[model samples]
Target: MTTLQVEGLTKVFGRGAGRTVAVQPMDLEIDTSTALGIVGESGSGKSTLARLLVGFETPTAGAIHLDGRPISRMLSMPRERREFRRAVQFVAQDTFSAFDPRRTLRDAVATPLRVLREVTGPAADAEIRDVLGLLQLDPALLDRYPSQVSGGQRQRFALARSLVVRPQILLCDEVVSALDVSVQGAVLNMIRDYCETYRVGLGFISHGLPATTFIADTLLVMRHGAVVETGPTEQVVDRPEHPYTRTLLDAYRRGPRRVVAVDPVA
Candidate 1:
């Protein structure tokens, strides 16, 4: 099933000739229970596309269909909007900042369920424990504040919170960028595992090609507010077609190269 379909999506800021096209008529689709990665350098509009998907920002032109229904066209009904919000959730690049400094992790994670009236008392506790366990987060740390936890812990907590709401699709915006390399892999793998287990669709937005290559089934490369290229993740990483895509791959290659070389005995 097609979880998301975006067509002719354009997001422009400013006016006239001075307008900045954040996203220009982009087209994309994501299947159910799968993962797609959108990679781009800074200012490439990857995050802008994510914001549009989750209804955080209004697009200048075009349409987004979530489960075959156009989200942009449902503004008339409050019930539909609430349903849309419940169907999709976002995990920001920085979890610590997205959370409250005074709130415990459990309280923060439970905020959504509390508002939605989905669980209470013992049910809420079970819900929290289930989500945290799914994310591989230790139960002992639920009482800690965001500031007291490591970056990886915070990221896992963010994922836990998102999952607690039972969202069908998750828009993850560089959720692992701030973590240590070793921790990054663990948290990312946890995300993949959860998505597989729950059949939740994921759209991962990041500049890290190597990391994206590990979990994504599809890769979409954006350059200057447009999709430069897209294909299977392995194919795009191994055989990039667009010049911009090549540049991204080259930039991510490991180790220093001999930029200028001469015969050693010369």
Candidate 2:
């Protein structure tokens, strides 16, 4: 099985008395067939962790390993960097901002193929169609601009773009937080199914406990850039060992639940 490992991963900003630790030294391992959920309140370093995984930000300390091989050194070479990009993909929370407002869906989703040189011409077209279909996005919508679609559709398109790269691991940073409750469920299900089918390791970061429970097999709860609890989702959710985790669960239970109508995609 393919595995991604993080060892002593840490990130900090500023220096001296003004310094702030965004992500404390953390260790995690994710198998290709498994999903890991990270839940935390705002400024808890959830997004910072995701950025570190995807190489968006330089880590003050730590290393990322793919299948037991260190990837940080390989990332320095041109060819290896392209391969790294293909192996790891990211989906951001701001779907609208992820896409270029001026580009059509086809252009946005196909950019990875072109950049990665994975496929071209008719092959790329076919792959794009297949990925969009898997995401339950209408192929007709491919001709439309990002601004023309609903927020849910935009998020689905963002996922489709990520899928085109055929990544071994996918990092989703609050991808469903902006959607309606019903839309959120659909997107979550879609992500679960896609990861299972492709055996893609998933790192899902979210503030919503219920949503994390619905999607992740393992849970990592964080507070102030540190892990408060880590265990199987069921154990962590049902019998939280940490007060912070229990408080999170309690907050979710007290929140109002809203039901929204969702469309069935063939």
Residue 205 lDDT in model 2?
A: 98
Off by over 4 Å in 2: 256-262
lDDT tens per residue, model 2, 153-243: 9999999999999998999999988888878888888888899998999999999887888889999999999998999988987899999
Per-model TM against the reference = 0.91, 0.94
In terms of TM-score, the best-performing candidate is 2
**CA lDDT, candidate 1, residue 126:** 92
| All models, RMSD in angstroms | 7.5, 2.0
lDDT of each: 0.82, 0.88
Clash pairs for candidate 1: none
Please report how far candidate 1 places residue 39 from its true position, in Å. 0.3
- Lowest-scoring 10 consecutive residues by lDDT in candidate 2? 257-266
